[model samples]
Target: MESDYSSAKEQYAALGVDTDRAIQLLKKIPVSMHCWQGDDVGGFEHAGASLDGGGIQVTGNYPGKARSMEELRSDIEKTLSLTPGSYRLNVHANYADFSSTGFADRDALEPEHFKSWVQWSKENKVPLDFNSTLFSHPKASGLTLSSKDKGIRDFWIEHVKRCRKIGEYMGKEQGSACIHNIWIADGMKDIPVDRQGYREILASSLDDILSVKISKDYLKDSVESKVFGIGTESYVVGSHEFYMGYAVKNQMLLTIDMGHFHPTENVADKLSSVLMFVPEILLHLSRGVRWDSDHVTLFNDDMKAMAEEMVRTGKLDKIHIGTDYFDGSINRIGAWVIGQRATQKSLLRALLEPSEKLMSYENDGNYFARLALLEAEKTLPFGAVWNRYCEECSVPSDLQVIDEIMNYEKSVTALRG
Candidate 1:
């Protein structure tokens, strides 16, 4: 394997690409793994409550799903064992650890609600990122932040305020800036007579929620927009243009979820345009099939384009990549490992690109040469370098990881029943 990597290194070096540096850089880029994948996004908020609405759906009745916070953490650890490079755990507010005592409504949630998670992160050395749970609750039946009722809106606003405080606490405790992403399922099923009114209320609610200042070093705030959700096909309150304008004016990071946009839209192309106005952006990397259906990410062209765009623009540092898909139909642990590994592979391929050479060709008006080099680079020995990276990280590079996952399911998750 070492000799193969050496030979591949020589091949890449001919194109002015250093495979060793690419591996090291890929190791430094951490992909935030979403915690909800283990539990099918059925957060540990209220026992016996089904994940019915919220513009999100997890198909399949695959058993061995994590039923408790401890089990969820255990499954995540197992998944991380098979994945290469460093990573952060992304948690939703609904996943708060209140197992001992029943539950607290969203508005009354405190940092202590998530103290266990912070402690676990510290112990495991995995940094934490957070999202306010604005769906699946009774209050979220119609609207949340954009609700016409002042009381309902206030509840969500206060909940988000507390969530931001918790995000700050986690970042301070873990010694890294925790990104608090706000995504609400505030939209209408049919055409509303007052689209402007709802957006106005949403803007006001956001202002109130974000007014509670937290140091940027401790907590970075971001707002995510969606074109449409399950029951929100007609109108979505936080549309792309709405949040883009708000993010620019408020200087907040705009989060672009891969599954949130129209199917025809290439989210990779939007990164350079968004980054031109915003200092930094957050990405919710997910595969969208037909609509915003969060399918497990694959090593497809979309993934390649996203990675290539980041590399091409020289703005990899300006983006925070995070996985946001949940596939309950398959082994939950396998889903996490596969999605994360695919993302890493895409990044590795991107880093291996001969950007300097390609740019030189373009600068000399040699478009044909540039295109040829781009296409030729794809056939290079990226697989060898990826295997070498997995070896260095002490993880299985081939299908051997699948056997490990099967053993874990039989010995661990299967017994939960």
Candidate 2:
């Protein structure tokens, strides 16, 4: 394997590509892993809470899903062992650790509710990120934050406020900034009489929520948008335009979820434009089949294009990359490993591109040569470099990862059933 990597490295060097530097750079970029995939988005808010309410849905009935915070952490540890490179755990407010004591409603939540998670992150040496749980609650039936009923709106606003405090606590404890993302499933199923009224209310509600000042060093805030959801097929209150303008005016990070836009819209194209105004942006990397289905990510063209654009623009540090998908049909740990590895592979391939040479060709007006070079870079030995990276990181590479997952299932996950 070393000999093969050496030969591939020399070949890449001929094209002005440094394979070793690419591997090193890839190792430093951490992909935030979502915790919802381990349990099918069923948080511990209540024992039998319906998982079908939110604009989101998790398909299949895979066995061995984590039923407690301990089990979820165990599954995450196993998944992290298989995945190479650094990572952070993205937790939803619903996943609060309230096992020792009784349940606390969303409005009553505090930093104590999530102390165990902070400790677990510290022990694992992985940072924590947060999301306010705006779905699967009673108040979310009609609209939250934008509801005409002021009481319902106040409930969600208080919940989000507490979530921001918790995010600050996690960041302070971990000595790194925790990104607190806000997303809501607040929209009407049918065409409404007053679209402007709902947006105006939502804007006012957001202003109130953001008014609670938390240190920017501890908690970074970002707002996410959606094109359409299951119950929100007609109109979405927080459309892309609304949040884009809000994020720009407020100087907050704008989160772009790949599944939240139209099927034909290229999210990669929006990155350069959005970053031109906002200081930074967050990405929820998910694969949408026809709509926002949240399928497990693959090393497809969309993934490649996004990674290529990030590399080409020379703005890798300005983007926060995170995975956001839940596939309940397969081994949950395996799902995490597969999606993260695919993302890392796409990034590595993008790093291996002869971008500078291609740019030089274009600058000289050699369009045909530039096109040919771009096409030829695809056939390079990317897999060889990827294998070497896994080895350097001391993780199972190639087909060996499958065997490790199977072993884990037989030894640990299978016994859960």
Candidate 3:
């Protein structure tokens, strides 16, 4: 079958990538949504501070100076105006609500709100991707299971059931309309010597929760195709390793967040392990510190190396661009877009460059160039209209949209040759 270049051009133009070739390149790229509430707990303190209780101290950042819905809508318009094809705007359930002790204090996610949000998102022509929907204990400080944490375990079990219920309901009605996002905030610190039981409990809960999918068949034959994602966290691993088992058990082929793994922990090996197990891996793109801290996408040399390795190893196929930006700022939106663009360009260059004797070891393969071409030909842009509204006032309009993207393309292409 002949590839229609005109259709491709139209599609790319819609997403803000102007060049016909760039659009064509972006056509095959998979884009997914990432969701987060600006803050999990609105100004408060952890009373008594149970291991699984909320322990946040009010840092005076509340009532987070956010933009009105109108501003957000305008940003959405701008985003869609650039990339007009099918893309996802990932969202979470707790953005406007609060939770305590592993329970969403808001009772249930209001049906009206969900419908309205989904409807509004579609009206803006942006598909919604729900993340952390099943993550029930946003208000909790840490999640664990022990004789001391039987309470936490009880909460964990109940939370899992609650999430399963939500998945079932949403699956029945609007499940197919959006992606079913999953990430675990369940882990504990200052553990007792008996770690075996802790691992068993967490792993069992995860298995049981995953089983909900099969029983409910949320992804079975829904009207809207649901995409499920699992995330990794640096804090998850320790000397004995509480998170390694959890990571190993994520057998489903889904999205992988780039910033979740830390370099101090051998990110390359962790990522490689995930890739090896999950045949179909979708990457969540973001930049983080190698030592500690997921401080947004300020590029680093180690990350460049990791990205280069992932691409060359054919892991780019399961990748999607994502920004784990927590701060409510217009700059966050811009940073997400710019960061992905810059990272893609830089990685493309690394992938495309011919074999050189720069490293101690080398592989005689054309895979790197091939991966670069694949990424260049098929990367998709996500529209973060809501984030823009939250941070629009503080951000400086440094460059024209076209100019920024063009520079991105040139930089990536220059690195390519």
Candidate 4:
């Protein structure tokens, strides 16, 4: 293994790339793993409250979906064990630990409601990010923040405010800014008679929610947009235009999910433009087939392009990376590991990019040579560098990791009754 890496390192050096520096640099970037994946987006807020109203639909009935916070944390621990480098946890408001008492509704939630989550983070040395739960609740059956009904709109606004407070508490406890992300399911299944009206209300509700003064030292707020969702096949209130304008005007982070756009739209192309205006960016890495926007991530052309764009931006600190996919057909823990591994590997390959020569070729209008070099890059010994990185991170450098996941499923998740 050492010999292989040594040869690869020398090869990369010939292209003005430092493999050692790239490895060390990639280790410092934290990837926040989504907690909803562990339980198919099911939360403890209500009994048997599966994913509803949200464009999201978790299809698989894989045994041992986390029934409680304890099981979920245990599963997350298993996931972290397999994935290399730094990581944080992303939790929705619905996933709030209600096990302390009987239950506390979303609007009434406080930091105390998430005591278990905080303790778990401290125990595992993991940081956390928070999301306002805008789906599956009674008020969410139709529209939430954008609902014309004053009562329903106010309810959701209060819920988001509380969610931000929880994010602040989490950030303070973890001593890192907790990314408070806002994504709502307020759209029409068909062409709405009042698209502008709904958007107006949504903007107002967002203003009310963001009016609260949460310090950036603790909470970094972001708004997420989607092109369309299951029920929102026709029009989404928080379309890319809505959130992009809001994020830019408000100087907040804009979350760009890869699967949240037209199939032909490349997320990689948006980064350079979005970064120019927004203060920072939050990335929800996901892959959808045609319309479903929550497929397990893979190291495909789309992912590679996104990673390369991020590295070329020269603003790693301004980016928050997180995986946002759920696959019920496979072991849940294995799903988490697979997505994160792809996320890490994509960035690792980008970090090892020979940008100098590639850029020079382009600047000199040597397009043919540039294309030739890029095609040649695919044949490089990237596997050697990746293997060495995994070995150092104490994870398997080969497919044996799958065997480990299988062993865990048999012993842990499969035994769940």
- lDDT by residue for model 2 over 1-417, one digit each (tens)? 989899889989999999999999999998899999999998988875566556877888888888878888999999899888889999999998887767899999999999999989989999999999999876777899889999999999999999999999999999988999999988988998889999999999999999999998899999999999898999999999999999999999999998899999898899999999998999999998886558899899999998998888898998989999999899988888999998899899999999889999999999999999998888888888999999999999859889999898888888888
- For model 4, the run of ten residues with the poorest summed lDDT: 47-56
Superposed Cα deviation of residue 57, candidate 4 (Å) = 1.0
Alpha-carbon runs more than 4 Å astray in model 4: none
lDDT of 1: 0.91
Return the lDDT, model 2, position 35. Answer: 93
How many residue pairs clash in all the candidates, one count each? 0, 0, 19, 0
TM-score of each: 0.98, 0.98, 0.58, 0.98
* Lowest lDDT 10-residue stretch of candidate 3: 220-229
lDDT for each residue of candidate 3 in 1-417, tens digit (9 for 90 to 100): 013434544444553434433324443443553433223222111222111332212122323222333333343444333432235565555442222233234234443434544566557645555543323344344553222366655555554355445444444554443335445443334434545665566556556556654432353211111111122222231222333334445545444455554334445444566566544444555554443233445446555565666655665655444444343333323434454444444443344323232221234455665556445533432122211221222322224545643554344322323
**What is the per-residue lDDT of model 1 for residues 213-274, given as tens digits with 9 covering 90 to 100?**
88998999999999998899999999999999999999889999998999999999999899
**How does residue 33 of candidate 2 score in lDDT?**
93
Cα RMSD to native, each candidate?
A: 1.1, 1.1, 11.4, 1.0
